[model samples]
Target: MFLDASGSAPMTNRTLEAFQAGLADGWADPTRLHTESRRARQLLDASREAFAEALGSRPEHTHLAHSPHAALERVIAGIFTARRGRDRIVASAVERDATLHAATHVAAGHVSSVPVDPRGHVDLEALARELAVPDVALAAIQHANHEIGTVQRLADVAALTVAAQVPLLVDATASIGHGPSPAHWDALVANPADWGGPAGLGIVALRPQTRWLPAWPEGDDWAPGGVLVPAVLAAAVALQERREQLDATSLRLHRMVGRVRDAAAAWPGVDVVGDPDERLPHVVTFSCLYVDGEALLTRLDREGIAVGSGSACTTSTLEPSRVLAAVGALSHGNVRLGLHPGVTDADIDRLLALMPRVISDLRAEAGAPEVA
Candidate 1:
């Protein structure tokens, strides 16, 4: 019944069990020299190694943070400032508010957002132009948009950034469990909650030999003085388990998602958004004209369905989704559905069946004529 996996996925049994085990084995201060602390350090190290192995990164390159925002904000502070003369940060317009806000806050208005096409793909030429600027410090792009599910041409943009010798920080969160990591990205941030892990855990991965510095009260960036050892192990275990089921889950989601896209498109006021073919299999978005986003959400809730409207920070705002606005899509009644492991055909069927009537009813209340 929960379709809003992007907001927070339900923790799996494997992950929950891992959490319990982690609590038992990893609940001591790892910095201490006591026997319990040594055991905790061993558990933490094992989690880091598992995370690195799954991500195709070295254990040394992985850093754990309280959240993805914490990880990316730290990255911008640590790496962006280290470059000295290069102060401008290039980011895609469709990024979730965390990166956009983080870069703007970190760079203090020096963030340049490359516009997205109406389908939500980033403007590659514009990004290349931005990267070519001598003052560009770092470039940030999402592997796939969390709202519209539009998969970016990351390899294409990564090529441009590489040639420009600008570091690329990819928020590969939306696609981490569902697809392969963009092998070319320089630094990556992922929230394990996006897969099946417990909330409040994030991963930041840096390529070896990267020029970076810890900006805050920091010792070793990778080996932070403090960490939630239980959360870390649970996150790594969840990521591994999710990746193992990705192919099967993706195939199932593709069929269900197409049904959703078709359903939304069939409604007169609802327009299916994002790239039709080159998008995430597990997510779909649509904008319903003559309806209120908040009202639609409430109606869906009444029907035993749940979905998300925008970023974690912005979904609660009355303003339209920044991502939809960037793409020139109608945002008044925007709806985004993110499928997870437990979502079923019946769940989707209920949504597809319930949506048209809801949109129709809302439009009728708004004094609009009914769809034929």
Candidate 2:
């Protein structure tokens, strides 16, 4: 059974149907004056409305971007461009590379990173201190850590940013569909594909009172050209479906992840990471001593159980996970299991049954000494 559900997920049947129907109905240019274009316009508007409602924002304030990375960059660029006098970007150490890179670029390398605890929770006092600093353009924090799944103290962070009068840019790309994001952000960006929607659609929302301007040249302001109407329709449909089942899905995945954590922790030289009780329901990460991340993942893949290793976002690079490194964990030999709604109990069982032997054999291959 394939168990790797790290960054993206498969679309549900209902969402697929909506996408198929939209392909036939929403193909025209939404900005044109033709009847077909008008139909496409309606589809785009309806999809934006549905997605905006999910985010607790008005459709007028939301924009469709090509991807979550684009949306995040747009938000950061807009804020920094409008607040020209301020050149500093404040963010937590555990945020996505997209957030850090964009913030750094916009702020001219004046980005200040707040430290996080070993469990991946941000240091609130340090964050407040950083925000209080002058010339701070914006502060960015994720709703949760994509790698370790530690939910941030966003409400408290929001309070601090508000007190400091700095715009808060929240990256909810990892947390939106899995649970309710805090309604305390000044600007927010999310990924549709992360929640089992079609790829290539991103949701970006801004509060009405927020100070932001398009940083791009005088062209298509929000999205460079436009968004795919069928993709947006599928994303909206998928988000609605996920929201309808959020509570039950969260509970079920939480239990299944707990099983994985428990099973992994019982093995020798294994350390389970993240805030166990207050983490994302679907994500669990752990580090194994004397085991190579790639080898362990390869063994699991060979055993018909696919999984993820290294940085959740930059898994292709296979570099030691910066998230794990920040939290002072062993970054080299880690595995991240992202449990989706489609992962069955039998799948979890099969993984649990296979892990001990896999770890033991890998340790033996490494000529590693036994853990005390």
Candidate 3:
């Protein structure tokens, strides 16, 4: 039971085959004037359209980057540079690390963050107030919180952005394949790995009329050379598959996540986090008091069940998660459980049975008094 889909997903067999084929046939430089190059170009061009269509954008507006981190960083910096007059960026506090880092790098001291509620939802009123500032450069927010599974009120926020005439950059990294397209954002970015594609590719779509300035020349739009064609094809295929199974997968995963929420909530010293209803169907997070998150993970791993955690003890330092901190969560002994298509009812049952016992055991081991 490997339940860490939020970190990285296991590639399907088709995805591996697609990647192997890309290595064999797409190795040539697409920009070269040769037969092999021509073939590579064909694959690259084809995948571009497929990727755009998958994200509900026009072919002309999409570009594939080498990695999601590079895509988000460059896009954020490029847009920030182009919109020189706009001096500030407004983002929710709970965005992924890459987005928050880019926001800080691009806007520095001018970066203003909108706080989230205890439920991990962005403060819409505060966002509106921030966006109303004429000097606001852009608004950056995630389509969903990967850690907490909180889905923002996007359409309402988009309307506020429109009224304020601020461009929106949405990090759809976690939500793209898990649910519906986050439409109406001026720009969007997601990782192929998030949806069971290869980790090498990142998808970016900028609306045709969206105000964005490329840091490089127009001729070398995405990069100096072609991207990973095989990864792009695999991403497109994965996206189509995700859409086809979206409703059913959503219903099934939502039920499983509900089971997790119910079990974790009932356990002593564990607090279920995120919006129980308006959240990602595959993700549920909880914090256990008086237990070290890493110890719980190790204990669970020994039982052949792997999960993810977000504790100060597990992260870089003894610092708690900024996400949990932003939402007033305990931040110690926090675990984020993200499910995928690979997960079965048995896996859910295993997790439910293992979670409470390990958490309680870890608490006891740490010499902490147990709660009811």
Candidate 3: C-alpha lDDT: 0.84
User: In angstroms, how far off is 239's CA in candidate 2?
Assistant: 0.6
Q: Which one wins by lDDT: 1 or 3? A: 3
The TM-score between candidate 2 and the true structure equals 0.96
Task: Give a tens-digit lDDT track for model 3, residues 1-372.
Answer: 788898477877777777778878878878889999888887777877877876888888887788888788877877787788887989899988888888888788998989999998889999998987799888998889989999998998899998998889999988888888888798899888888887877778888777677766654366546577667767777766777899999899999999999988989888899999999989888999998888878888888887888889897788888889999988888888888888999999878877777877788888998598
Write down the lDDT that model 2 would get: 0.86
Q: Would you list the C-alpha lDDT of every candidate in the order shown?
A: 0.83, 0.86, 0.84
- lDDT (Cα) of model 1: 0.83
lDDT of 1 by residue, 249-346 (tens): 98899889998998778788677889988888898888887777777888888887888775222355566778888988877777888999899998
Q: For model 1, what is the error of residue 293's alpha carbon versus the real structure, in angstroms, after optimal superposition?
A: 1.4
Model 1 quality (TM-score): 0.95
Q: In model 2, where do residues sit more than 4 Å from their true spots? A: 311-318
Ranking by TM-score: 2, 3, 1
Over 4 Å off, model 1: 222-225, 311-316
Tens-digit per-residue lDDT, 60-177, candidate 2: 9998888998888889999888897899999889889888888878787698999999999989999988987788999998888777889988889889999999999988998888
- State the displacement of the C-alpha of residue 220, model 1, in Å, after optimal TM-score superposition: 2.8
Candidate closer to the true structure by lDDT (higher is better), 2 or 3: 2
